[model samples]
Target: MTKTEKTKQFIIEKSSVHFNKIGYLGTSLRDITNLTGLTKGSIYGNFENKEEVAKAAYKYNAKRIGNKIISALNQSPSGAINKLMAIVDFYKNNWSVIIETGGCPLLNAATESDDAFPKLNIEVRKSFIGFTKIFEDIIKNGIEERIFKHDLNIKEYASTMVMLIEGGVLLSKTMADKEYLNISLKRIENLIHNEMKL
Candidate 1:
């Protein structure tokens, strides 16, 4: 990467956690400057505005978690059901890492960007939709392999899994209670085993 590209990425890496932790409205230009040790002028020289920085930061945060999930999914054994279990264990095992870093980036961005940050709102929504499709694809493949029930409502269940997982993240973060997320995830795992499994 060019010096300019590397500098922009450096700023994104440094400020991404802060943005996800506090949020768009909560984060200030000073925060970015302070976190990255870059002057306001230098930061602005790289980006058009605070909104642009925020959009890029959110992408960085989301991709970090996505990479973790993808890695876990790829390493799982052949069965589709095992693939789904790998996703569950991925979240469960990474809870500490995620919570320490300021919780799920998509949830954090979506909640904070609801009205004030329109561009970010679109990005956050797309992230959730993409995540939901991962579950849908896994379940569909499981059914094709006769490892999961054929009548599963792919759309509803996939959407619910994403929604519930995000909700658990919020509760866990706010309450500082891992049990909140643990309970919700248990429910999801139960559905996968008892209801979906063949």
Candidate 2:
């Protein structure tokens, strides 16, 4: 990459976790400068403003988690059921990282964007819709394979899974107990096995 591109990426990488942890309004130019060790002028030279940097950082954070899920889904067995299981296993195994890194980026962004950060609201909503659509696609494929029930509501089921998972993340993080997430995930597994499967 060119020097300008590399510098922009560097700023995004350094400030992403801080944005995820402290949030958009909470994260300041000083924080970015500190994280990136770049002077305000240098940082601004690479981006139009803090909002631009934040948008890029949010994308980076989302992609970080998205890539992991994609990898897990790709590595799973050919069966559609196994793909769903792979998603469950991912959250079960990776909750620590998600927690440590300031919870799920999609959840964090969505929560913070609801009342504030108008610029980010659209991006956050699009990301979540995209995520829910992933589950929908899996269910659609499962139905085609005759592995999942054909009568299921694909959109509702996918949306519920996202809600349940995010709710679990919030509860687990707030309560300092993984059991909350465990319960939620267990419910999802039950739904898949009992409700979704044929």
Cα lDDT tens digits for candidate 1, 5-93: 99999999999999988887688999999999999999999999999999999999998999899899999998877887788888789
lDDT of 2 by residue, 1-198 (tens): 999999999999999999999997679999999999999999999999998898889999999999999999999998878988899999999999999999998888888878788878888888898889889999999999999998999999999988989999999999999999999999999999999999
Q: Name the candidate that leads on lDDT.
A: 2
TM-score of each: 0.97, 0.98
CA lDDT for candidate 2: 0.92
Clashes of each: 0, 0
Best by TM-score: 2
Candidate 2, RMSD to the unseen true structure: 0.8
Backbone clash pairs for candidate 1 read: none
Q: Rate the local accuracy (lDDT) of all candidates.
A: 0.90, 0.92
